[model samples]
Target: MNEKNFEYLRDQVKYTGFGEGLESELKEKMQQQEPSFSLSHNAHYGTDTATVTLNFKKSDQSDMYFFNSYKVDLQKDNSKESLEQTFYINKGSNITMKEAYNLMEGRAVNKDLTSKEGQVYNSWVQMDFKEADSNGNFKLNQYHQNYGYDLEAALSKHPIKELDTAKFKDDLMDSLKKGNVQSVTFMKDGQEVKHYIEANPQFKTIKAYDGNLKRIDNRQTKDEKQSEGQNTSMKQENKRQNQSAEEDGPAAPQEAKKRKKKQFNSM
Candidate 1:
């Protein structure tokens, strides 16, 4: 959230004086989680766990400042019910913000999301993170941090999709692979998230990617095909007209000249 605003102290929890090199240590810890995992820290009160609400980026920019709201649980007991989902990620593991964003953008998961009651299309997602103690109980890390992301920003930069495993979508796949950027997304519990990229083709279009071999639908794709066919027909017709005009060009001029000469001789 807003590092400058009161959020830094929303729970009235000061950034506890972690030892020097804590940031480096944390960064190293984060690297361990790389290639796929997340570690979470919570704010703990006496016997209660502090809470926070993190909103997805409602707009284009970073709303972590105000619009996106979140809580930091401070439950000493990793097993206690406190803010957000509590779980302990193994040591030497942490998730990057970009990887976290890819997870939500369908970088990893291709399962279609079913609409839940009261959940609108643009509704917020209650993402969870965790850190564990020696007792195997989930606890917050020393410095509570979550892999929060701005949904829109994530989508714009790296939009992922579940493409049909069929050959038809090869074009789109090629586009996605163009930058040669290797991206991998993982869930907190070590579940794999799989998805595909999109590249729209004209002469033939892809409709859906849900079924095996991508069930082909003639609905929207037909529109593109129609446009392509129309353009091709027009191009051929123009080519024929130009050829006819060129073939008759010399004859027409010669005939006109002969007619003028006959008129002059008769006069």
Candidate 2:
């Protein structure tokens, strides 16, 4: 969506409030009978009108729930001209403006957001913080306040997938043995959040945690592999060319030198 004159409230809703809500409502509307979900929307008019929408859903089928919120704007009294900003929320946890953009930029979750069951909880804001460069709009903190639960423990308690179970065990065991993990992530209710691995001495990539395997980008993996194969073939062809040139013996070099001398003498 697009807007004409209002930007403040849109910024608050898009970068700060929650994820997109208009589509979320449609999703709930479509999936209403499958499960009962709620989409509550509020519009705040400060110099202009801003619509904020939030959605919630539950699926015990997978022992999980999902929540998302978003915002839209139709300013200058031109109802046809609408500007929309959307965000996703897991359970009640939300992504800060920076985290959202960072995720878009392909950043990985490096913080853990879990505590041992029955353990005292700590605030997420207590950790180190960073920010992103403004596209001349607003300055967004690179990290946000953690709002979810301990990811490792929760996953161990309720695995997302069968494969996730094996990965989860290794993550926990690595934590116990190595003593520190820079970050770990988990979902609560329906939202995704992060936690810092307290025993972090070396940073582990998500793929490594998932078994030190290479993560394949489904969209480009095949193309990438083909490109590598082509590069190897090109290298082999170049090697053959160089070997053939050497095999042509010193006669070619002497002839080339003679040609060079003739050219210089003619000059």
Candidate 3:
């Protein structure tokens, strides 16, 4: 038996979020020296359950094996049909079993991805259920750092009590980045209101939910709404002024001055 190969595969399985319990079975299968084999694992997260099958392939020219990919069969409590996705493994980084479940649940995950050119970059990845590749797998949508979605800044826009402390804030950020819908307290009307929030990187915001798990529209504040209305009015006024200038030509400046003076007097 190749002790080095067994050790490497064991570590890969553990790091990929299958835990250390599969070490013995992995060693046994590798010792058989089969050209290919697979291991199955069952995991439960809340009311959802997932069965993950890890694939292994042996090199034809060598006595080495590779842990290439994993297929996740997710059974969600709210849906009748099960969701399935295959995630490939690489030398740089791979999604964990929990992260895979989150992705299947239609949530985004933050990851440090290595480009084909060997450059490391951070991005938020979500599965596009509406599209599928030739392999019948959902396509992935990546929001790179340049996409300008700041998770921390988006969280700060809400009145979340978790962000009041350094430790709590870090914990909340970690949970949300892993695609968890975290429970938090909102300081609403000077009282603590329990709410759920999930990271919505695609929209550059956090989605809020009531205690009953119903989504609530809390994206904007009263002040922000008023500011948006004011900006819209200003834009309309500018557009009108430009139309008048185009029509009146040389006398446009005089008309604009009169309008500005009249508006100032009314103010």
Candidate 4:
């Protein structure tokens, strides 16, 4: 990416008031703790100056984002030049403003942020249809701003070890490939225990070795087959049940009439 495009993307990032508050709260908590922790950013947007607060667990652990929050501006500008609309983000949800806008961008141009629940939380993308002509650059396009509870992107660009499952697999494979297996610490029940292993050159042929990597199996074919068979069985069962119910429907009334006749005859 060139400097100009980099700057454009940097400038395009939007922030919101709720996101600011959450960020502040996180900072305060982190600073006060004796063993310091830090809040990371998962995703974010610009326009409303929105931000997302990513509270990670203790160090060197799994990588996951908690919730996010951003403010809402419920006012509109009446000026002929100024434009306004409602936008929002949520406190918790794996959503990004850019992703959301791309999904529903032109579909609902004139829509407002009245509906909160479908998928994008309480926020919708809004664009201010005004031009900014200041200092020398004449902005002809609409002043775009994303509104809602904002999300923050991670400050650390590099992928963390615990976060990437593939890294763990690769590390294991590389160790075996280099013939470095003798004894090593393996994670078990949140505790690391030392394990001894015999060096096998043809490790791929070993069942025990392959069994450990079975979690990576691509189940698309087997799962699809199982799903189709289950659906067929269910349809057949439902058809048989419906047919039996239909056949019994008329016989039930006839049996009732016969029982009534027998009762009358006995009387």
Best by lDDT: 3
TM-scores for candidates 1 onward, in order: 0.25, 0.23, 0.81, 0.16
Q: Of the pair 1 and 4, which is ahead by TM-score?
A: 1
Error of 2 at 78 (Å): 9.2
Report lDDT per candidate.
0.32, 0.39, 0.88, 0.32
Name the candidate that leads on TM-score: 3
Model 3, position 80, has a per-residue lDDT of 100
lDDT of 4 by residue, 1-267 (tens): 123432322222233222343444454443453233434333332332223333222233322222222222221233233222223333333223433332222211111222245432233222223433343222222111243211111101111122236575456444332223223343333334344322222111111112232321223323433554555565675566556657789675565556557755874
Q: Indicate the residue-level lDDT of 2 in model 3.
A: 79
Clashes of 1: 24
Model 3 residue runs over 4 Å out of place are 220-267
State, as a TM-score between 0 and 1, how close model 1 is to the true structure: 0.25
Q: Which stretches of candidate 4 lie over 4 Å from their true place?
A: 1-26, 33-65, 79-93, 97-267
TM-score of 4: 0.16
Per-residue alpha-carbon lDDT of model 2 for 1-267, expressed as tens digits? 112111322333354534455444444353444453544555443344555444544555642334444433324343556444455443223455433333323333333333346333323221222432332112222222344334354333321232246776676644433223334443333334343323211222122232233342322323433454555565675566556558878665665556557755874
Scored against the true structure, residue 81 in model 2 reaches a CA lDDT of 64
Residue-wise lDDT of candidate 3 within 112-210, one digit each (tens)? 888889888999999999999998899999999999999999887777778889999999999999999999987654567888989999999888888
Model 1 global lDDT (CA atoms, 0 to 1): 0.32
